[model samples]
Target: MIIESTWHKSSYSRAETNCLEAAYMTTGGAVVRDTQNRSLGYLEFSAMEWSAFLVEVKSCDL
Candidate 1:
């Protein structure tokens, strides 16, 4: 029941210590986490939720 996904870091993250990673789940959702503290786990978001979040981020609304 475990799903595996490839995590990717943002290209804008030039500093190793200050980076976030994201992975797309098999269920069509996504997960995001701090690259520096991966052992802490990640935040899961549904596909719609993830899209809304991306829109807000791009618009600087949050």
Candidate 2:
């Protein structure tokens, strides 16, 4: 199930549009959505998946 959360963007993101917003899930995961079209809904990731994603991102492997 998806949990409601406060959406936020990367600190490095400066553009007002086309950016992605993410929120923490109470169940140790995350939800992501587009900044431009919130009505499109969001994507959820498990904690393990989320951690792997962050590792890839930090290593510029994504």
Candidate 3:
């Protein structure tokens, strides 16, 4: 069964139209996408992968 995700934007995002959105998948993973293009779809990442990505982003290493 395909489950819907609850998408959310970053609290730190500027008061602009363009931003990023993310959602947790029912499959124990997460998905991210651009707020400006919902039709383009999203990128999926495993829980572990998402954690590592968050670490790098916090460190400004991306």
Per lDDT, the best of the predicted structures is 2
Comparing 2 with 3 on lDDT, the higher-scoring candidate is: 2
C-alpha RMSD between model 3 and the true structure = 2.4
RMSD of 1: 2.1
lDDT of 2 by residue, 1-62 (tens): 65667888967656865688899888889998887788999899999999999999999987
* Candidate 3 local lDDT, 11-43, one digit each (tens): 766657668888887776689888878899989
Predict model 2's lDDT versus the native.
0.84
Q: For model 1, how does the per-residue alpha-carbon lDDT over 1-62 read when each residue is reduced to its tens digit?
A: 23467899977676745898898877777898898888999899987998899899899988
Name the runs in model 1 displaced over 4 angstroms: 1-4
Query: How many angstroms is residue 38 displaced in model 3 relative to the true structure, after the best TM-score fit?
Result: 0.5
Report the poorest 10 consecutive residues by lDDT, candidate 3. 1-10
Better of 1 and 3 by lDDT: 1
How far residue 4's Cα lies from its native spot in candidate 1, in Å, is: 5.5
TM-scores of all predicted structures:
0.76, 0.82, 0.71
Whose TM-score is higher: candidate 1's or candidate 3's? 1
Q: Which stretches of candidate 2 lie over 4 Å from their true place?
A: 2-5
Better of 1 and 2 by TM-score: 2
lDDT of each: 0.83, 0.84, 0.80
